[model samples]
Structures are given as structure tokens and as C-alpha cells.
Target: MSEPLLEVKDLNIHFFTDEGVVKAADGVDLIIERGKTLCLVGESGCGKSVTSRSFLNIIPSPGKIVSGQMLYRQQLPDGTTTTIDLAALDPKGKDIRRIRGKEISMIFQEPMTSLSMMHTVGDQITETIRLHENVSKQEARDRAIEMLRLVGIPKPARLIDEYPFRLSGGMRQRTMIAMALCCNPTMLIADEPTTALDVTTQAQILDLMLELQQRYNMALLFITHDLGVVAEIADEVAVMYLGKIVERADVDTIFNAPKHPYTQALLHSIPKIAMKREELDPIKGMIPNPYRRPSGCAFHPRCSQVMERCKHITPNVTAIQPDHTVRCLLYEDMPEQVTQKEAMHHD
Candidate 1:
């Protein structure tokens, strides 16, 4: 396989509160290849949003990155492989700012908050370009319009001058995508970019992303809880629970041969277009509170196939196939003693 464009290794992000440090993103490791979409999928509050936010260093002040690294592999001017570690850089450092938009960019879940009401849409996009590149105002304007056109915004020249509020819901999303791609960054991190948009708009946004991804050949880390979104555009999928990644596989393997019970339940919860409303299935139980997360396997309480050991021991990620990985006792190569104990329960 080609070297990953971005590698997140054992990443952990926590938030300090009067109660305690809440682990929002923990031990997340995944790879994003160039020109591919690798989505983080799970229910709300399962750390899907946190993981993507962590990439852009947008986690609020109370939050702390306890450990782990975000590594970006790039070719140096000398044609050597150079890995820049994002987590290691200080927040105020120039390196982080230079990379934030030029090498890595993020589209927030809410466009209104990210977009400035004071500035015209054209100015907003150009402002980002001006921040990162030493380009003339006219050049930035042209580049901004080009980005808008690339994202399928209609009549880019006219639309670019309008304020965020002037655009429709779907148009606002497209504007966000336009701003995110302004720099042609090596990686794009989108956190629930389609939320609140109607179904038809959602489909259009996903199609636009795929088209832009192919045109730029940049790696995409799509953070979402929607399995329908995953089915639409993900080349690979990562299942996150609490703050840890539980299962990761190609879309086909995940949808067909999920090893983690939690992943299976998540897939089962997706209402198929062909299924009637009366026959729809939803996963039982709510996402456990992060502060009061269960010991051992986080999903054990909700996992129907949970073994006794699951409640007491956190299973290490095991590879079922080269393309599939899961963290669950069921896939562990337990010794005869442990295997026999589990087998007895199964029998």
C-alpha cells in the first residue's frame, strides 16, 4: 500500500472540568490516503466530532491533548520523506498556523459560526487566502471565486459578494467547502458538514466533495455519525465509541462482516431505503456518558455479544483481515484456558 498522507497515532484529547478530565478523544489511530475519504462513524457524543476537531486544534481551552501524535508525511524539497508531527507543535507556534490552512484545513459543523456576518462571502474566502499566502488582493479574489466555482456554487462571481445570511442553507455549506479548499491543503477535516441540510442537499454536498476530492487528490477525514453518509461516500470507515476507535475496515467489509458487536449494531440501526418504517430497527440504549464511561470495553454494556471478560478487560485491536480491524474479545487469540472459559459460556 502507498504511504499514508496523514497518520494519527494513539491520539488522546481531554477536557478539564470541576468534576474531572473528560476524555473526548482517546487512542484514535487511523490513516488517510491521498484522494480517498476515510470517515469516522458512530452515534452522537461518541467522539467522532472531537477526533476531527482535535486535528485542527479547535478543541476548546479546557480541553487538553494528553498524548499521541498527528503525523503528516510530505516530500521534502530534496525528495525525502519528512514527517511533521502536529501534536508536538506549540499552539502559538508559526508552524501550526502555516500548516493549519496551507497543509491542513477544517470545515466546522456550523457555517454561521465560522462565517463572519460582517464580511461579504467573497471577502471571507479571500481573507483566508491572504492569511496564508502573500498574494495580491485581486489574486486572492480570483482564487476565492475559483474555489467557489470548484465546489459547484452557481454564478460564483455574483454569489461571492453576498453575505452568509443571503445564501440558502445548502449554499452556505458550499461556501464553507469553498473556504476550506481555498488553499488546496493536503488534508481536509470536515465535521458533520451536512447536518441540518435536507436529504437532497446532503446528497448534493457529498457528491460535490467527492468531485473536489478527485480534482485535488487531497486526503479527506470525514467526521460524521450518519451511516447513510458513510454508505454514500466513504472509501473506508472507522467506528468510534467513547473516545477510542473500535473497528476500522473498508466500507464493504464494515457493512458486511463487522467483527465488533457495536459496529454490527450500528449498521443494523441504519434504516434502509427499501425497508418500511414499521420494520425499521434502531440500536438499543444511548451512548454512555464520557465522564462515567464503563470500565474495560466501553461498548460492553450495549454489545449483545459481550462476553464476561469484556466487562473486565479492554480488548486490544486485532486484525481479522488485512483490511479489517476490531477491538473485541471475540476476535482475540485467547489461550486454551481463556478460550475454554469463553466457549463454555457460548455453549
Candidate 2:
């Protein structure tokens, strides 16, 4: 097997403020293979976005990555691979700048805020292409228009001249996609790319993303709260709570045989069309304030299967089966009992 496209181990990021320090991402571990989609699913503020931003060292001011390694296996021009530690590089330094956009790019959550209203969409895309590639202005413009067409933007020749505000929500998102793919990056990080669109438009965007991922053969780090979207796009799913990944497995295992209470709650919360008579089972309580996260398990306060150990001792992530891991005490002592309970609940 080939080395993973990207691997993160024990990544910890924090935001320091006058109020308190926000432990945004703590001991997060993830791996993304080439041409695969890894969905980072969790409620808001679970560190999904922060973790993805760490890839490019783009975390905003007051936030710092305290420790951990971001190993990127870069494919060199000579067809060999070089492993570089991205976390060690200066965020705004030349090395990171060379890697960003050229090898890896991101599409942020909101296109309105991500795109500049003053510039034409075409110019923005061309700027990104020129920033990474040594191309003439005319060549960059031609490539930008081609990318816009590739992303399903209609009348690319005309739309390229319009500012972001002139485009609809979906069109703006496609523009963002086009910009991110302008360099044919090896990896794409999309943070809730379809959250603001209608269902039909959301589906179209998702399909476009999948199609582009296939065409470019790029690894995708998709961060979102939508389980339906995960089911549709993710080959693997990681369930995050507070600042930790509570569970991770293949999409089928995550949805059907989830071990952690938090994972089960999230899955249960998804509305089902077949259960017309059933009420939505939203997760109880709310994500705790990052400054004062709950002791032991961060999800313990809201976990239905909570135990005494959960309130006092943090459970280590344990493997329930090959490639399936969960961080919960319920599986530590009586794994069978927890499995039976999950089975009964599903039935």
C-alpha cells in the first residue's frame, strides 16, 4: 500500500483570549488517502473546521497549534515523494506558501465571506492560478475560464467578469470550487461547502464535488455537520465532540454499528423519511464551552450511557474491531452489553 496523502497525529490547537483559553482541537488524529473522501462530522465548535485549517497553517490570530505533526507526502516533479512536516513550517513563510494552493487548497464555509466582492470572479480565480503557477496573464485567464466551465458555471465567459455579489449562492459556491481546483491540487479541504444552499442545489454541489474529486484524483477533507451528506460522500467518517474524535470508522460502521453514545445520538438525530410517525431525536444538551470543557469525557454530560468512570477518568480510544475505534468507557468493561444495547435500540 502507498503512503497516505496526509496524516495528522496528536494535533492540538488552542485560542487564547482575555476571557480564557479555548481548547479548540486536542489530540486529533486523522489520515486521508489519495483519491478518497474523509468526512469530519460533528456539531459546531467540535474542532472540525479548526483541524482542517491546521493543514495549511491558516488558523486565525490568537489561535496557535501547540504541538503535533502534520505529515504530508508530497509528490515531487521528479515522480518521487518527499515527506514534509507542515506543522514545523512558518504559517506565512515561503515553504508553506509554495505548498498552499499549488498542492493543497481549501473552499471555506461561506462563499460570500470567502470571495472578495470588489474583484471580478474571473480575476480572483486567475490570481490564484498565477500565484501558484508561473503562467502569463492571458494563460491564467484562459485557465480560470476553463475551470469555471468545468465547475458547471453557465456562461463562464460572461460570469467571469461579474463580482461575487452578482452571482447566486450556488454559483458563488461553484466559483469557490473552481478557484480551489484551478491548480489541480492533490488535496482539497471543504468546510461545509453546501450548508447555505437549497436541498436541490446542495445535491448538485455535492455531485459536482464528487465528480471533480474523481477527475482530479484528489484526497478530500470534508468538514460538515450533515450526516446525510456524509452518507453520500464519505468513504470514512470521524465523529468529533468538543475537541476530540469520539469515534471513527467506515461510513457503514459509523452509521450502523456506532460504539460511542455521542455517535449513536448523532446518528439517531438524523431525520428519516421512512419514520414519518417518529419524532426527531436530537442530541440532548449542547456543546460545552471550550474554556470549561467537562472533565473526563467531554460528552459525558450529555451521554445517556454515562458511567462513573466517565465523569472522572477520560477513556482512551479503543478498537472495537479492525478499523473501528471509539473513546467511551461503555466498551472498556462490557463491550457485549453495549453492542446488545445498540442492537436493541436499532430494533
Candidate 3:
């Protein structure tokens, strides 16, 4: 129960279009502890990526954060500490720039698009190092080689001059990891860094990330739709649907005693090894259209446990225990203390 490294409170991001404002993320809250991983899990287009992107102020055009507080406990070089509200800072201001790559870094989902095809792998890594650190070219190049070696690249000296296209998928992902870690940031936000790789390669990349996380004692915010991966790497889990976080708990509780219907459905949907492919039970409905979001509880339309009230009144986030919370009417009568936020309960 140590102080969290970062806390996101009531985050709301929207995409303004000719049609209407798409609520990509609505009142999403999350906490990341030092040296631990918090996996943001949900179906595709559930606002996981949008919420994480806002951490670095990289929300794409037409999408803007309308409200929220991203409180970060930053440790300065002089053995002092300061709390900064990242949401209020100008996206292109000096404060955010200093924090972006130096204290907080992101590993984008696709390295192919994230990396500059024009530059060699060595050049990309060195550019990151020099961006946040004052160093000579030779010094930066040497650091880049060391990083490549650390990420398990072979013959780093020679590969330093090769382009990213020359590397295999796994190698390219490892290179991306190298570039992200070269600055030794205090936290790393990885947005589905393994979604594009094969199963075997996926496991390797996961292990590499976990190993690096421990080596640097860095907090990690891992965004993915893979429950299996969450079971492997996450210390805590947050289940998101249609921009709202419906469940938050430790990984074990999330798997063993899930509270939210969306969470239960997601777990049931995971393909089990013993079950036949045709026997799998997937969640019934697709994510609703953002512009036409359902009334009251956004999930009621697909929820098996939905009640009459759920179709008319939004459910408040109810805390069932110290380490667990659920946004569902079923838990409102629980004897345990309920930390209710009436203000955030809305359609």
C-alpha cells in the first residue's frame, strides 16, 4: 500500500466529429504503483489505447482530453519530490517535453510505423538517448550499442548500422524495447507491444519486458486485450468498456472472483486449452457505436445480469473491499464500505 507512482482520476477524452462528440474515455480512473504492472484490459476500441495516449499528451487530431487529473509523483535529481498534474500542462510546453521521454516513455503498438524507416536502428536509439541527455555523438552511439545488447540483440556493434527493415519481427520489437529503455525512464507505457507477434515470440517479448521492468524498478502500464498476458505480467487489472473502467482489482482476484459482468464475460471468452474451438463462448455483442451509446449503464444491453434499473440509472463505482471495486448495481447493497462518487455516475 505504498504511495502510487501515478494516479489518473475521472479522465475523459473525446473525439469531435461532424456527426457528434465520441466519448472515447469517460471518467476512467487508474493507479500505477512503483515497480509493478497494471494491465488495462478490454476489447478493441474500448478506449484502452486512447486513455494511455493521453498520459504522454499524444492524443491524435480531432481527439482531445476534455477533463481529468493525471497526478504523477516525480522524483527530482536533487533528492526531492514534486507532484505534477500532467493533464493541465500544455502538450508542447517545456514541462511535458522534459517529462515525456526522460521520466515517462511509451512503446507504441506498431514499431514498423513508430520507427522511422529512413533511419537505421542505431540512429533511432541514439536519437532518443541524446534527446533527454546531454552527450557527445560517440558517447550516444556507445550507449545505443549497450542498449541493443541489453535487449538481447546479437552483435550489437554490427546491427547498429542496419535498418529496422533488416530485422525480424521479434528483433524489431526488441529494438523498440531498446529505444524505450535507453533513457531509463521511471515508468513505461506499452500499448499492446506483443499483439503483432507469434505466440512464441509474444512470450519472449513479455519476459524481456518483465525482466527490464525489474532491472530498472520501473512502473509499467501495459495496455492489451489479452487476459492470458495479463495473468502473466499484471500485478493489478482494470477492465474497461466503452471508455469507462468497470472493474479494478489485483490480478488474482480478477481471475478468481470477478465482480463485473463485462469482466466475467471477457474471462469466459478466453479460449481454454481443453475446450474445443467451436465450444468457446464469446461475449454476445460487439462494442456499441460511440455516437449511439446505450442509455443508463452503457453495458446493460450486453450484460447477462442486467436489471431494470440498469437500463435507466447509471451505476456508481462501489468499493466492495479495500483492493476491489466494481461499477454495477448488483454490488450496491454489499455490506462492505462503498466509496461512491455520485457525480461521475452518468450516461
Q: Which candidate is the best by lDDT?
A: 3
Candidate 2 residue runs with Cα over 4 Å from true position: 274-278, 333-347
| Candidate 3 ranges beyond 4 A from true positions | 334-347
Per-residue lDDT of model 3, residues 1-347, tens digit only = 78789999999999999999999999999999999999999988889988998988989989999999999999988977799999999999999998897789888779885688899998888888898999998999999999999989999999999999888989999999898899998999999999999999999889999999999999999998888899989999999999999999999999999999999999999998889988898999888988999887899999999876677667789998888999998887633222223323532
Candidates 2 and 3: which is better by TM-score? Answer: 3
- What is candidate 2's local distance difference test score? 0.89
Worst 10 residues of 3 by lDDT: 334-343
lDDT of 1 by residue, 1-347 (tens): 98998889999999899987788887888888988999898888877776777676767789878999988887665877888887887776787888887778888778986898888999999999999989999999999998898888889999989999988989999999899899888888888889879989988898888888888898899988788788778899999888889999999888888888888888887787789887876777777877898877888888898777777677888989987889898898878687557546544
- Summarize candidate 2's per-residue lDDT along 117-142 as a digit string, tens digits: 99999889899988988999999999
- With a 3 Å backbone cut-off (N, CA, C), the pairs that clash in candidate 2 are none
lDDT score, candidate 2, position 242 = 82
Candidate 3's TM-score reads: 0.95
Q: Please report, in order, the local distance difference test score of every candidate based on alpha carbons.
A: 0.85, 0.89, 0.90
Q: Which stretches of candidate 1 lie over 4 Å from their true place?
A: 77-80, 336-347
